[model samples]
Target: MHETVTVAHDDAAVVKMADLFDPEPATWGLRGDPYVWAALRKHLSGKDIPASLNEVLALLHAAFDELVGLDLVTEPASSVYREQYAHGGMSGGMIDLDAWRQRLIPLLTERARMRLEA
Candidate 1:
């Protein structure tokens, strides 16, 4: 459900969606998870989503491409790096964003963020 769009940048969504490749409908907690979805639906109870699925899809694609192109952004399973990566498949809890951010925030730089945002 997650209708509010907690994060503005689509890269995060794109990363989540990338897990849905090659015909697998990837599960992203609240997004694809029944329990999480129910919670989010309740969280946004009675409110309308300002954006449509296609809009979300486009944003994710853009963010994903931007991240992939090294427009200065980095992915969780960093396409650029291997040293900092956690060794596991997409289904593991390792890719869970809170975990990713906990690990990534220290490694990523303000300079990188500025560069990427620019």
Candidate 2:
């Protein structure tokens, strides 16, 4: 024979619901394979990012999606790149691949760090 048990909560606990569901923003962390950066860099070589923020974001999204579709990069990495581009800023202007490479170096480094840690 087996017995089942039930747990009960007091009304007072509900008062602290805010704490139970903390609103603090989580720290940003890389969430993908670092090697993806290398692949992206290679793919982007000699190409330029569009001057328009919208265009740049769209390009990145598409490129990342294709990489994921081809299994070249993990889905998580693509997701992280999407998030990064969204919050990167509104600044937009035609930038060569080298310039874009410099800008994304930090993100790539972080991704590498996360990969190492994992």
Candidate No. with top TM-score: 2
Give the C-alpha lDDT of model 1. 0.31
lDDT of each: 0.31, 0.37
> What TM-score, over all chains together, does every model reach?
0.21, 0.34
Worst 10 residues of 2 by lDDT: 16-25
lDDT of 1 by residue, 1-117 (tens): 667756566643322222222122234321212222233233333332223444433443344243323222345442232222223444322223332234322222222233234
RMSD of every prediction: 16.6, 16.8
- In model 2, how large is the Cα lDDT of residue 69? 45
Runs in model 2 with CA error above 4 Å?
Answer: 1-32, 70-118
Note the residue pairs that clash in candidate 1: none
RMSD of 2: 16.8
